[model samples]
Target chain A: MPKIVDHEERRKIIAKATWNVIAREGLGGASVRSIAKEANLSLGAVRHYFQTQEELLEFAMQLVQEQVTERIMEHIQSHLPPKDQVLNILMELIPPEEKKIEMQVWLEYISYKIRKKELQKESVHEVIVEILHRLQKAGLLKEDILLEEEIVLLHALIDGIALHILMGLVPIERGRIRYLLEKELNRIFVE
Target chain B: MPKIVDHEERRKIIAKATWNVIAREGLGGASVRSIAKEANLSLGAVRHYFQTQEELLEFAMQLVQEQVTERIMEHIQSHLPPKDQVLNILMELIPPEEKKIEMQVWLEYISYKIRKKELQKESVHEVIVEILHRLQKAGLLKEDILLEEEIVLLHALIDGIALHILMGLVPIERGRIRYLLEKELNRIFVE
Candidate 1:
């Protein structure tokens, strides 16, 4: 009997390898062949999953996004108070110890997009909007805030903090990212 | 007599060439040979000033800093009011058609630093603090703001805005960067 391969498992493995390649050598080094080598898969196997480097990169980005979403979903079920949940979700967007790879890979994707003169697909924007909607639904969003402006500001704040952390321009004190996250959250949300 | 060379002028020319190379091929492509070819200078001539690629990259960054300082000084001499002066100086830091090369090269340097796991020396920090001090001296700084946090926040905001511009994630509207800058300025300053 032929061995059965779990396609999802194989994909997750490939994406992990893609992130490793990006973190190790930047986007330039994450070619399909290199990612195949990193994943310990044959070139044919990698190509069977992703037809091109761009496809592989896009999947890698989605993997990052999905990891954040999964973590947030796991945390949201813990029955934390609404504000704390928002804090937790917003904080999750930044680099904690375990999330460092995700943040770095995400930045590499952004840098790649910059070099290509393309805008990212606004999925990150969607994530921000989704977070705000949840906050509003939970009655945690402040009434005085201009919703659109607040969203843009918080998006910029998240981008700034992540960039700072990845660049090592800011110290990675455990609570420092949370501190900034809370400060921005308070500006737009009622405690 | 040896060929007369103004060391400072040659250095500036090489730095300009360096920026062009970085803009064209990223930091990875700014090797000494390529930079020499870009500048149309002999490899020995280029090596006479910058002994290694690392030294050449560092000098390119310093050139970026000097260019910004020169522009700000010229703007300050225009005798605008302190608020307008601050606005002009801050705007000079972002891409304004003429400064796009500087912004791109500076970002490449930053991305290079991130990959190298180094912290930028505090020259940019000094510039931010200097601006805040001028604001206070001009009676424009808000009383309740935490100066240090505000400084860090403004630095991150400037960085975030520039990254957005370079990424084409944000439209390059002339007023857009200024809008973000003014929002942060209003947060920290009385005006």
Candidate 2:
């Protein structure tokens, strides 16, 4: 009998390789062959896990989002205070030291999505809306602000900070920018 | 003298072609040959204007930035009130209908700059700092905010709003995001 490969483990391995390829050479470098080489697997082995490059990239992008969500959830759970929970969740979206490469890879994927129809699906938007709804329900968000506008602004702020942080214009410390974001959030929510 | 080719006019034509190529195929598709084809000019003609792809892209990027700055300056010269001037300048940065394509091309250039070394040195950063300084001088910015942090946040907000506007998450009306930004700015400046 042929050995049964652990499908989930294989997916994780392929996704990690995808992240590495993206980080080292930008989104253009995350080809099947490059990912295979980064994964230390043969092209056939990589294909055995992901049948096509598109499928591989789709899964890789989803995996990055999942990782971000998971980390945020973990941080939220650790913080008992509601304000701390919100702040911690926000921090998770920023580049944690271990996840800097992942964030960089994600940025490349986002840029690639701009011109490509297949990658422009609104799954990320849905996830963002869900988070906003959660915050609103928890009374963490100001009632006066339009949910959609607030959500859009939040996403933009995150993207902006990510870009600046990557460019080294913003320090990694969780002080000034964090205060600014939190303060803005407070302004939106009624006392 | 072969008509001397009107160097400034030729540069504008080349930059416009670069913009078209970016709009059509994105930054990845922006090449000398592609730009020449888009411009309906010979490869030699394009090469005569720009010696390298990097030089062409850098020039195109600078052109976009300058266009934005010029628009802002023009709006400021209308002699509006201080708040109106701040709002108008900020509104100009958002994807105005007349300049949507140019703004999209500019975003692509910024995404490209993420992976490539900047060719124009400190000019872009300096210009942004100057804008921030002007806002501060106008007493529209908080005195307590650190200049570096303010600049970073301002740039991020501009970029973030630009992304949202392009994606259609926010309304195209300059008044909407401008109002939100102005509110935030007021929060910072209002004693």
Candidate 3:
């Protein structure tokens, strides 16, 4: 009997390889052939899994979104208090030492989508908005806080810090990121 | 007598053309040929002005930084009060409708630099830090405000909002941006 190849597993393997290529060479250099080589697969194999470059890149982006959501879900299910739990989720969005590759891939994807003028709705922003709403309903946010404006500020601050960290434009250590984030959270969250 | 071609003017024109190409095709697609074509100049003329792509891009980035610095200086010199002066300078960093192309080119340069591991010191961050320190020295900031932390937060928030607006990930309008920024300023600045 012929050997059975797991198509789903193969697709995921290809997507992860695509991420690596983007992290190293940027989205512009992520050609189908290059991705296949990085994945240690033949050109035909990659093509069989993804017909076009756009299709492959789209799948890669989807995989990244799903993985990030999974991580966030794990944090939500943990036993930490809501405040620390929220802080942890925000930290997850900003890449630390190990998560660097993943976030770098994400940044490239964002840049590509922006240039193409086909930017999809950023799910990260929605997650933040939803979390803030949840906290407000639980009476954890300060009474004087304008919910809508706070949402906008917090979202922007998180993304801006992430970009700065990624670029190494500012010398932001992990402790500093935590401190800055915790301070902002304290400003809006009820003590 | 031979026609006198102003060397400085020609170089500036080439740099502007480089910015236009970067804004439209991204840094990856910015080539000497493309930039020359965009400038409606001959290839030899572009080569005469900038020897290599790196030199051309470097000159282009310098022009952007200088232009931004010049605008900030103008804000500093204006008759607006300290608070309004700071707000106006911050607004200049975030691309208004007319400043979109310049910021687009800047974003592309940033993305490219990050990939190449060549990110230089971002002058904008320094300017923010300096301005905050000056305000605190003038006793304009709240007594309880942590100067260092506030600086980091403000820098991140501004850049983050700029990124979101550029990407259209959030429907942030000019008024909303001003409101969000002013509110943050209110939080830190003494009434």
Candidate 4:
């Protein structure tokens, strides 16, 4: 009898293997052969799941986005105060020590997309805008804060800090990330 | 008669060609063979300036850093007010329309270095830290502001914004970048 495999499960596993390959060698090195080797699956088996390298990469990128969104959604549903909720949600976007690989993979995907002129929409920016809008609706934001500017500024701030952390260019530790974010929240949130 | 090339000038030209290759294709596409083709020189001619592709990439990266630094230094020496000067300096780090190619090349170089575990010192971060310190020393910064935290925050914010701009994720125009940076400066600098 032939062995049976769960189609969706296998795709997830292959997507993750793709992430590993991307994180290790960048998008350039994430060949179908390498991904198959990393996933411990035969080339034919890998091809059965995703027809092309672009298809596999696109699926992997979506998985990364979904994972981040799922985590952020958990933070949003928690019993934390509005300010804390927003801060926590922002923190989810910037990778911690353990989440570094995901961030690296995402960064590589982003650079590749930009060069290819794909111009995909970034969900993180949309999430930030939505969160800020929700806060404003709840009367949590200071009246003086310009919602549009804050959205742009906060989005840029988070991504910039995340990039710095990934590059290890500066000594921005978790403590500093939290402290700086809290300060910004304190400035914009109603006391 | 054999052609006479100014050694340093030829090297700089080759480095610029490398930047063009990196910007058009990711760093992975920046092989010496392609670079030689891009520079309209023979492979041996290209090797005469740099022994290897690694050497060429490092030189190209250094040129990007120098170009950015030179622009920032010009802003620093300007007669603009301290706040305006700081804003201008920050603006130089985030590429405008004309400087997009340079910024793209820098981003790729940074990502490539991180993957290689090279951990090169980022001059932009150092420059930011130094600028903030100068402001504090000049008594331009608010007394209550924590210099260290501000340094980390500002650095992350600028980089995040730059990344977003480079990726075209958000519609952050030059005016918006200026507006946001000025706002941050306004909060930190004493009127």
Name the 10 consecutive residues with the lowest summed lDDT in model 3 chain A. A165-174
Q: Write the per-residue lDDT of candidate 1 for residues B1-191, one digit (tens) a residue.
A: 88898989999999999888877766655688999999999999888767765687788889889878888899889977776777787777666666777877776666666666675664555677799977777778888876766766776666666666666555446575577577678777775
Quickly count the clashes in candidate 1. 0
Maximum-TM-score candidate: 4
TM-score of 1: 0.77
Score residue A1 of candidate 1 by CA lDDT.
100
- Residue range B1-191, candidate 3, lDDT tens digits: 98899988887898899988877666667888998899999999988867665676677788888889999999999999998999999998888767766767677677667778897677778899999999999999999987877877889988888788777755657777887788789989998
Task: Estimate the TM-score of every prediction.
Answer: 0.77, 0.85, 0.89, 0.92
Pairs that collide in candidate 2 are A142-A189
Q: Best by DockQ, which number?
A: 4
- Pitting candidate 1 against candidate 4, the one with the higher DockQ is 4
Interface RMSD of each: 2.8, 2.9, 1.9, 1.6
Docking class of 1: acceptable
Candidate 1 residues A103-149, lDDT tens each? Answer: 87777676556556676565566777788877787788888766666
Q: Write the per-residue lDDT of candidate 2 for residues A15-119, one digit (tens) a residue.
A: 898877766665545678888888888898888766664576576778888888787778767847665676667767777557677666666665556556334
Clashing pairs in 1: none
Q: Which residue pairs show collisions in model 4?
A: A160-B160
All candidates: DockQ: 0.35, 0.45, 0.59, 0.68
